[model samples]
Target: MGSSRWIRPEIYPLFAATGVAVGICIAQLVRNITGNPEVRVTKENRAAGILENFDEGRKYRENPVRKFVRGRAPEIMPSINDFFSKPDL
Candidate 1:
């Protein structure tokens, strides 16, 4: 009786929040799959806008060990400028 009345309001908001989260996740998944924003800069001549913010996380990993071990090594992820700086090609 009283419990049922209390549950309805709570459950509706929970369901609505879940639906919003799922919608956002699906939208991001589709965006990544379509390469609309290109999360990684695979080639030099491809595009530059994708990697502009890639180094924004540098401040948090000032230590050498933290920088290299956090799974974003330079070899594995050369900076955006490196793509055009290398003379060897």
Candidate 2:
């Protein structure tokens, strides 16, 4: 029984883990083969994908807090460069 073959008792845990992973993969494959249905985005669910995507297009628009902080300065950041840039005056 002390003779070391291809499979060792010390490596049993690794074998078990590999078996579990293989089983999970096989389960996923079977599920895929059986046609796992996709979920459709609904308007009532407050679908985030489109809005989140389009929101990036609104990055130039000033936010309320930004408007409060910089007032008209936030709107002019991209166009005008030298404003009240004095360090000591």
Candidate 3:
């Protein structure tokens, strides 16, 4: 019983190391099978996409904010103009 007890403690570390190695192998196999590599977004490709969209008939004035601000022009401009207009005596 004494020799068996001495051997059991030494085997725990070997079991733990084997478990870790198995986990790493499984993770690598999953990565290989999925064929999904990490996506790398560089500034050059992002800027090129944006430039292409802008070049392909996308104008700043066509933006929703510009349309909305222009839509509110009559509401805002008339108020300011009314305030600054000469008051009749």
Candidate 4:
């Protein structure tokens, strides 16, 4: 059958390699079009010190809600290693 011929295991690696190559090419094309080539230094930016730049970058990186959640660790699942390490009574 036509379907069985197309489903051969030997063809899978060729398909995977072609998919990866196409994905990389598309990503590079997108980055070339949208990515900035150089940083622009305005009068305000030039006047700003390292601490001011750091604060500005921090504000841009995350909002208040994200900042608050970042401090706490997620406890979705207990660690298996820690569970096994405890001495049984």
Indicate which candidate wins on lDDT: 4
TM-score of each: 0.32, 0.36, 0.32, 0.38
Q: Please give the range of 10 consecutive residues that has the lowest summed lDDT in model 3.
A: 31-40
How many Å off is the CA of 39 in candidate 4? 16
Candidate 3 lDDT over residue span 1-89, tens digit each: 66886778779999999999999999867745443223225656545543334332445325566677774654657867877795867
Winner on lDDT (1 vs 4): 4
lDDT per model, in order?
0.63, 0.58, 0.60, 0.64
**Least well predicted 10-residue stretch by lDDT in candidate 2:** 32-41
Query: Which candidate comes out best when scored by TM-score?
Result: 4
Model 3: per-residue Cα lDDT at residue 88: 60
List the candidate 2 regions with Cα displacement exceeding 4 Å.
Answer: 1-3, 37-89
Clashes of each: 0, 0, 0, 0
lDDT per residue (tens digit) for residues 1-89 in model 1: 76886777659989999999999999767756554444454665365553554354353235456655776544755776687777873
Candidate 4 Cα deviation (angstroms), residue 57: 21
**How would you encode candidate 4's per-residue C-alpha lDDT over 1-89 as one tens digit per residue?**
78997789999999999999999999767654444222335657445544435554555456566888795667545477558767777
**TM-score (C-alpha, index-matched) for candidate 4:** 0.38
- Which regions of candidate 3 are displaced past 4 Å? 1-7, 36-89
Model 1: ten consecutive residues of lowest lDDT: 52-61
